[model samples]
Each structure stands twice: as structure tokens, then as C-alpha cells.
Target chain A: MEKKFEIKDLITVGVFSALYSIVMFAVACLGFIPILMVFMPLLCPLVAAIPLMLYFSKIKHFGMITITGTLIGILMFIIGHPYPILIFCIGAGLLTEVVLKMGNYQSIKHCVAASAVFSLWFLGMVIAFFFSFRDAYFASILDGYGQEYVDAMKSYTPTWVFFAMIIMCLVGGTVGGLLGAKVLKKHFRKAGMA
Target chain B: MEIGVCSNKNGAFIKLDPRSKLLLLITISIIMIGARTVEVEGVLRLICAAIPLVLLLSIREYKASFIYLLLLGSALICEKHIAPYTHGICNIVLMMICGLITRFVAGYMMGWYTVKSTSVSEFITAMERMHCPSFISIPMSVMFRYFPTLSEEYKSINDAKRMRELGHPFSQPLTYIEYILVPLMMSTVRIADELSAASLSKGLSAGEKRTHICEVSIRPLDVFAITGTMVMFVLFLVY
Candidate 1:
């Protein structure tokens, strides 16, 4: 079967890729405390807003989404955020895709949960890569500064960080769904994608 | 569609095969990075870095190359006087920026080149021709195409952040993180699935040998560029 390639599809890809990269660049630019990025708000919400996955659910695009993720990975990798950033992205992306599938793309709960799980994987990767143990080696670079770095470590806990991350992810996902639902629903209506 | 970043250069720089460019970037990057201390090694790296700057100028990509040198120069300046005052932030920022600039330029050039000549099918085929594992090539090809997609997503995420932050008096870093990650992750999962399905529907079988739409050849221009790269690279090293 000779399938016609739509110029519009390419346009769509271009738009989304650009949007995705911008989101990553903005949030990822600001350094965090732990250091968690204070700009996480700018990033997660926008990403969650785009209904790319929902569109995928109806269509299941082949290389489009993965390619976007890969570009983001390369951009950051080029920027030098250590190895875990890339690892987390790939790991978390896969996890989210799996979770989305688990829900059969029929339930909003599954989508939200999937995004949360996806982000958690990245958080976990960060902890494992930087710290020796939970709360034991929280501030990675400060470990060398000894008491100076360690002195301030007392302001938080691993559980707190985890909970914070989960909340953030939840908010992010919810917002993402809200934003994505409209565009993606329209996208799905204009079908033959999957 | 540009295959590599060099296309933007538009001169002799763009004439070289992407493979050569990759080789040059890798070799130069390793040597520069290997210069352990700023004294003997750092000085050498600075000199070596100049060669690329000149090539960039000749290619008319002076701006990009200048940005690269600026990073190295700033690092040198910072390491000399501001090291202790800034608590090493200057050095760290400089090194990372330098690293980022080099990779970004190299990737850009290669990406430009790939798009100009090779079709997606050709790229996949070439990997197979080179004896690359399907597992590896499939992912690489996927990643290559994905680059633009990711960049796009980042753009939207950035805009959303801008909107929210601007809404408030002083947007903190925490606020940014809270919003960005959610959308970014959401978009990622969405597209990945669609792309996977689309590629599948296209019957993108990895096992089959593919065809090449663009002929890849090493021209005299490539030789000249590489030779120029070597001489300058050596001059920088020994200087």
C-alpha cells in the first residue's frame, strides 16, 4: 500500500518539536536547590498541556514522539547535566509510554498516573546517580565541602523531596491533560494517524 | 532540511563529508578536553581553538565560532583572577558552555548534512550497510528525526513558563519546575507512542536492506578541510 505523506504532518511535527525544545530549554535552564530547578513550573505544566500522548493514543505515531525526546536529550547532553539526565529521560519516557498503554488510552487517571510515574523515574535516577543513599548524600557537589555543604543539608528530607516531586508531577500532569485534551481531541477527530 | 550544522556555514566548511566533520569534532574535542591544567594544556587548547575559529570565519560562520572562542576565552580570564571570588562558578559555567557550544555546533552541522542528502530510508539503509545492529540504527535514526520534535516541545514549554512567571511578581525557580516538567513529560509520552505507531504502519522493518538516495563521496574539499584542521590543531597543540 502506497501511503501518502501529509505535509501537514510534517508541519505538526515541526511545531511540536519546537514547542518541546523550548519548554525543556526554559525550565532546564534554571538550576534547582538540591539543587531542584525552581523553573520546574514552567516546564512540567507546558509539557503536560500538550496533548501529544492523547493524540498518540488514538493514532500511536511511530517515530515522531521518540524523536522529539531524543532531540531534547541531545540538547541537554550537549549542555552537560551529567549522565543521569539522559538516562532518566529515556527511562522515564519509556515508563510513561508503558503506563499510557496500561490504561489503553481510555482513562484520564491512567494518563496522569503514567506521567507521574514517568517523572518519578527521572527523580529516582537523579538520586541514585548523585547520592550514596537517601538523605545520606543529598547535596552531591557539597559533599566535598564537608561541614559547609553538610551544614545546610538539614533543611529537607528525602521523603519531603519525593513528596514534592510527586505533587509537582501530579499538578504537571493535570495541567497537561487540560491543555492537551482540546487540541488532541481535535487531532484525533482528524484521523487515520494510528 | 539540513543534515548537519555545517550547512549554515555555506562555504568550504560545508563541503566536507559529515563523517570527516564528526571525526574532526571528536578528535579536537578529546584533545582540548584532555588538556588537564590550564598552564601547559589550557594554553595549548586556546591556541588549538583558534584554528576552528578561523575556519568558521572562512566558512562565514564567524558568529558561531566566535561564540565558541568567547567561552574558552572567558574561562581563561575567569580561571586567572575570579576563581576564588566566584566560588568556581565561573570556571564551571565556562567549561560547560564550551562543551555545549562545541557539541551543539557539530551536531547542527551533521544534522544539516544528513537532511540535505540522505533520505530517512537511506539513513536507515546506510546504517545497515555499515553493519550497525538494527537495535542501534533504528534508535539512532529515530533519535535523529526526533531532534527537531523535542526542540519544538521545549519551545512551548518555555512559553508556558514565561506566561505563568510573568503573571506573578517574581517567579521563583520552584515555580518554573512545577510547570515545565509536567507538560514536557506529557508531550513526550504522547508523541513517542504516535511516532512508534506511525513508523510501524509505514512498515519500517529494520532487517531489510535499504536504498541510498544521496551519493556520499569524499571530495578534495574534504581533504583540504581536514588537512587544514590537522595543521591548526597541531599548531595549537605544540604552541
Candidate 2:
């Protein structure tokens, strides 16, 4: 139950959470390709561990990830993305920390597994939310976009086409995160931080 | 022949302070968003913005931005000339150009206001900007720092082969993406060792306060630019 992070790490997480809102908002302005949007945070998580590892690599950094995850959750809510993004982040981070406690983080397998778990974390939340509240979720997306592009945005013609896009985003995000982690593993080592 | 990616101009821009650049980027972006659609307005915006952007890119003498420009220009032509079955090419091109002009405005503001002043600082302040922990910036910046260099290395590695670059752009873009991946990853593995050493030498531990040399003050020039952009934006909104 003891927190493993320093004060500044918390501040960093808060700043990044705020950044997510603006970055997503800006991306929304440019395009709506779900594939890219889903994987958008891939790069963030890729190198996200460096700071914690760099500073608190000595102390447990799992709790630090949870706090950052909460910040991201708050930021997403402010940015109008609904609530589960927060829950996914915390649960994923904490679980990854548990895995790390098993001494798995040192190897490439651990990084990849941690990434996959979180990737699934986001996917599970999106899918569950879609099933539980299909109409509301679709309505919110439409509200975010509006009725004008509502029809076009839904590439699938069936009423069920509504939730298909979320699945697509999740798939894209999962792939992107895996790729990001793999790439990150190499890059961090090259940068000499590993 | 590669398109849509920025050049090393960002590295130089990173030298400037961040606050100054943010004001510049936001102001210009507001103006661009405001003036997103008019034809005459679009072309004028392109010119006013393009001049500075070209000068920035010129420092690097990088052809990537020019190629991107060429692709954008060609896309406009295609959207006008080919994509629309009903409208004439001229009309489509005109509409496309008008839409693109807003991005030009946004692009220039990014370069002049934010990038020129605080390009490097963006990486350091990225967490603050993104809601992540500052701990992440070390790896993020390291990745960014090495990315362009790796790209350059990848390009040279490709030149060692024949038919890869020329054949990919005109004949197959996916081929281009495919060919580039291996070298980039290999380069990543090779460089990872060095990055680790560099970070360790610097004692880059998490929760540490990293210094930012890129300081951007909202100067008189910045105020004038913001005011001018806001006025123009208001005019566009009303008109």
C-alpha cells in the first residue's frame, strides 16, 4: 500500500494527462481515422517508463504508474471520452507492477507482456462499454462528431455496425502498442537508458 | 520523394524557448482555423505562411518538406481533377486548395511561433503537455533524438540497394514502408546500448527536475502577431 513515487513524478503525470486532452483534441481537428486514433497513445506508453525507471528505478514504480493512469483518466473525462479510459489505465498499470514484482520487467518478454495486458485493458473496457451501452456510446460518438458525418463515420451499414468501429480502434491500438513497445525496447537500450 | 514528414528544421526550432512558441503556434492556429475555407483568403494565407516556412526548411536544405509540398499540391490537383466525377477539376482543385490553406496557416504558426522558439523543450515538457510523468521524457526524447538520425541512416542504407526508392514511390508505397522497417529496427538495437550509457552518465533518474534552456517570452512581436491573427480570425468569422 506504500506509494513508490516522488512528488515530481506525480506532477509529471498530471501534466501528461492534461496534454492527452489537448493532443487528442488537436488530432480530432485534423482527421478521424480510427486506426491512428486508437494507437495514438502507443508512443506515450512506449517511453513512459523511462522517467520512473530513471528516477525511481530504485523504488517501486508500479504505484507511480497508477497515479499517472488516474491523471490520464481525469484528463480523458475532461476531454469528453467517457470514464473507462481511467479504470483501464489504473488496472493495467497496477497489474503490470505486480508482474514486475516477479522480476519480469528486466527482460523483453515482460515489456511486451505488460504492453499486451494494457492493450487488452483498453480493449476490454471499450468492448464491454459498447455491449452494455451500445446506443449511448454510439450517441456520444455522434454527439462528439455530430449527425452530419454520423452515417459516413459508420462504414458498416447494419445497426450493429455501430460498435464495429470500437473493435477496429482496439485492434489498431493493440497492434500499435505492441509495435511501440518492441521499438521502444530497442530505442531505450540504444539511447543507453536501459 | 518521401512525403508529409517534417525535416531537421524541428531540431533547430527546438533551440528557442517554449512559452514564446506556444503563443505563436496557438495564435496562428486560431487564425488558420478561422480562415479555413475562402479561396483568395486561402492563397494569401499560404503565401504569408509559406515564406517563413520555406526559410526555416532552407536551413536544413532538406528535400523532404518540398516533396511533401509537391504531394499536397498534387493531391489538390487529383481531388479536383480526378476524384470528383461531377465537378470540374478546376473547381475541385480550388476547393481543395482552400481547405489546405488552413493547414498551411497552422503549419507556419507551428514552425515560427512554437518550433523556432522551443523545439527541443517540447520533448522535455511533453509529459506536462500530455499528462504523463516527467520520467517518460528521457526515453521519449531519446527516441525522437535518434529517430531522424535513424531515418537518415535508413535512407543511406536503401541507397545501397537498387530499385527500392524509385520503384516504391511511383509503383508501390507499401513496398517503401516494408523496406524501411528492418534497417530502422536494426539501427535501434545497435544504438540502444549507447543511449543507455548516455542516460546513465547523466544520472537521469526519475522525479528529477530537468532544466529547459528554451525559454519563450511573449514579446511585442508575439503580441502583434497574435493580435493580427485574432483580428483576421474575427473578420473571417464575421464575413
Candidate 3:
């Protein structure tokens, strides 16, 4: 089979990417609860797993995953994410695509690994905390939320916590991917689609 | 239909190229994101917020622009005057409300204007002209086009669930979520397949330079908008 993305594959990518993004957006709305906002790294990937799994099952070519990532990155930027996050998102997508390629696009194990890596896109959003604006971010948090809240936040988000959040995101993705696979098997596969 | 505001010839007060609209969004987002990190001058913030409202008005989106203005005014007032007086939970809630508004509203309004005012064809043409690979442009356009369809599907699903009395959010929330997602995914796949088939038959896969009837050009207004945004961005950096 030719390894080129046809219009059908591209459109499938588009449709599924849209679904994945909508799921992500819906999950993000939960951030209205102040405490739940901190768990965004986990919640988004976990909740968004279903459509992504469906999208992955349809992937027969190389570029589909990267395209989905880039598309989502642009959407995020449009929705007010910082510009540099785009680069981070594209990198995560590319890395995930490589992981999926290692399994030749079929192995459930690789798909889970890919999901773990793809979840690093959340890292892009929080990356400013580790690198740029570390002081300003906290200062703003202090200003808006008061020193007590900032103290609570800082305690919750120490240097190690960044790595912990990364791990949490990965675990969320891994579990999500597995759950997604099961969902596909229980739903789409029995429907003779997957 | 008359394609978009770009093609509305005699109607729109200020016609902008999609490329320029995209540029304006990037500029506004950059400024607003910066505003969040450091307290920028209030005047600068106001200018940034006003850009989208003015653009919306130019497109004759009177109601949306007015609503945005009202929201911005109220949020500004609450943040400046009322927020300091509140304490504890109310304070945090007030701050959160103000922060979300200041951080997101301007960019969201600008995005709404960009998406609402520009047709998919015009967007694709702009992307193509900017030399974005068709791989990105094609799916991006399709994704843009599909958002409305997705929302429509979601509403119908909600309606169906209500009819069946199968799920409710407060009770059986997980089941309600599952009920919502499973059918949504299935219908999404089916619709995607149908859409792909239709577009393929329309020769979308022919893999040649496609001709579009929507004439997209960088008019003087577009030049002005792009340059003015860049100047503001440079000023933002320097200031």
C-alpha cells in the first residue's frame, strides 16, 4: 500500500482532531473550580482519549498524527495559548508519531507509549512555570490570589512537582490510551469499523 | 451565498484579508499573554481589547461587538473597583472571574471575528498563498468547517439522551458522559466517512493547483492592519 495521505485520510484526521479538541475544551471547562485547574495536566489527556484512540485506529500513514498535533496547536494558539507552545506541541506530536511508527502503527503497547508522549503537549502550557516568567507568574498569582493562596500554590507546585505533573500526565495518557483501546474494541471493533 | 465579508463588495465597511486577520489574532494574543505576566499599562490593554470590537463592528457584527464592549466594561469595573472590597472566597472568585475575562475575552472575541468573518475557501486560499503545505491547509479548513457540524451533532445527542431519559449530570454522571461520548464518536466516524467520500468525488484528491472563485487580495486596509499590528507589537516589546 502506498504510504501517502489521501484526501480521505486528511479529512478523517480533521474530523477526529476536531472531536479530540472539543473533548479537550469540555474538560478544560472544569478548571472553573480553582483546585481542579491544577489537575489539568491529567484530566485533559484522560478525558480526550476516546476520540484520539479512534483517530489513531484510522491512521495508516506517517503524517496524520503530526498534522493533528499541529492543527490542535494552532487551535490552542487561536484560543489564547502562547506562541512558543506551538513549537512544544509540534515536537510532542512528532515524538509521538515516531513512537507509533516504531510499532508500525498497530501495536497496542506502542499506542499507549505514543499517548504518554503526546500528553507532553500539556507540558507546553505549563512550561512557562519552569522556564520563562517563573517569578512573574508567581507574582501575578500572589497578586490575584494573595500570599496565602500563592504559598499553597507554591507548595503544590515545587520544582519536583513539575516532574511529578509530567509523570501524572504520562500516566493519564497511558491509562487513557489503554482505556481508549478497550473502548474501540468494545464499540468500534464490534461494529466492524476499527 | 456571498462567500464571506471579503466578497461582500459593497457591504462591509472594512474588508480585510484572511492573512491579515490571522496576523491580528497573533498580535492580540501576544499582547494579552504578555499583559498577564507583567502589569502592562492599562491604556495599552484597552487598545488591545478594543481592536477586536472595532473589527467586529467593521464587519457589521453589531450585537456581538456591543455585547463584548459591555462585558469588557463590566469586567474592568469589577476588577478595578469591586474586587478589592471582597475577601476570602468571594475575593478569589472575583479575582478568577476578572483574570479569565482580562486574559481570554479579547483574544476570544478576535478569534470569533476571524472565524465568523472569513469563509473556509478564503482561509484556504490565504494559507495556500502563504505557502503552507496543503497537508496543513486542507485539514485545517476541514476542521474549521467541522466545528459547527460537531456542535450540531452534540446538541442532537443531548436532545436524544433527554428523550431516552438515560443520563443526567448530577446523578450517574459517568454514565451520562459515556452515553454522550460513545454515540458522539460513532456518529463522528460515520459523518467523517460520508464527508470524505463526498469531497473525494469532488476531486479534492486530484492533487493539482485548485482554482477558487473567491478572490483574495491584500488590499490597502490589509496592509494598514498588518503594518499597524506589527508597529504595535514592536512598541509592546520596546515598552
**Which candidate should be chosen as best, given lDDT against the real structure?**
3
Worst 10 residues of 3 chain B by lDDT: B1-10
Rank all candidate structures by their TM-score, best first, as comma-separated numbers.
3, 1, 2
Flag regions of model 2 displaced more than 4 Å: A1-159, A168-194, B1-16, B26-133, B136-140, B157-183, B202-216, B226-239
Best by DockQ: 3
Error of 1 at A137 (Å): 12
Better of 1 and 3 by lDDT: 3
Predicted candidate 3 versus true structure: per-residue lDDT over B114-184, tens digit per residue:
87778877898899899999889988988877777888888999999999998897788777878889999
Q: Which stretches of model 3 miss by more than 4 angstroms? A: A139-155, B1-10, B36-40
What is candidate 2's CA lDDT for residue B56? Answer: 46
> In CAPRI terms, where does candidate 2 land?
incorrect
Error of 1 at A120 (Å): 4.1
Q: On residues B1-239, what C-alpha lDDT tens digit does candidate 2 reach at each position? A: 22112323445432323433444454444444334334555554564455345544644535645654665567445544544443443433333344444244335435433332334455466446555555454333443344345547756867854543343544774444335543444444445545555445655544366654443345575576556656655665565
DockQ value of candidate 2: 0.08
Q: What is the C-alpha RMSD of each candidate to the true structure, in Å?
A: 8.5, 10.0, 2.6
**How do these models rank on lDDT, best leading?**
3, 1, 2
DockQ for candidate 1, C-alpha atoms: 0.07
